[model samples]
Target: MSGRCKGGKGLGKGGTKRHHKLLCDNIQGITKPATRRVARQREAHLGAHLRGDAWDVAGLTPSHLELIYEEMHGMLQVFLENVIHDTITYSEHAKGKTVTAMDVVYALKHQRHTLYSSGG
Candidate 1:
């Protein structure tokens, strides 16, 4: 028989057990005030950059901006989730302890959102 024990729960090295960290509620971080602030900033930028009398005269209501913000926020959340999930998958497949920029690039490419360059 070999020196190593067989059919046993082997805690490698110093017998340290790995603990899985719990995921926090990230959605909670995007508070109503934060969303409002972002929406207002976007509205201001658009108002400043857009040309033509129609765009100049037309203004978005506060409620309209909020709705638009919610829609954009949801889409952004989904996109980030997909990208992060794919990045983690690639890292794990390569037995990597940390995610790299290349992992993100590859993940984006996998989702048909490829970037032209990964530099800097």
Candidate 2:
């Protein structure tokens, strides 16, 4: 506590837990101005300007297509599962046991979608 920053009780009797210890470190001492390289790295992650928007057929590879399809399929599966989960969780009886195919079927029927349309 002797060498610690002023105005905060040290992590001890009547003091905040260790989780808040960092808050006692004065921001002036903790923060530094960013170097040019760090700033450029951050910009590269986010604000890189688009190259010419002309038809980039050269970029369209089968692997890229497959990757896109895989990501889309994974997202669709997550959404469908969420819908089924919400439906089951909202029900009184179905909320208790392991969700079965019958439960999903009933939910989809009530929600007016086919089993395949439910995607599970």
Give the candidate number with the greatest TM-score: 1
Deviation of model 2 at 85, angstroms: 1.2
lDDT of 2 by residue, 1-120 (tens): 586566755456554445634343232231212222433454565554733332233477878755654554555456566766656764647544466666767677666654765434
Off by over 4 Å in 1: 1-58
At residue 45, candidate 2 shows an lDDT of 56
What C-alpha lDDT does candidate 2 achieve relative to the native structure? 0.53
Against the unseen true structure, what C-alpha lDDT does each candidate score?
0.74, 0.53
The local distance difference test score of model 1 is 0.74
Error of 1 at 84 (Å): 0.3
Candidate 2 ranges with C-alpha deviation above 4 Å:
1-60, 90-95, 115-120
**How does candidate 1 fare on TM-score?**
0.58
lDDT of 2 at 116: 66
Of candidate 2, the 10-residue stretch with the lowest lDDT total is 25-34
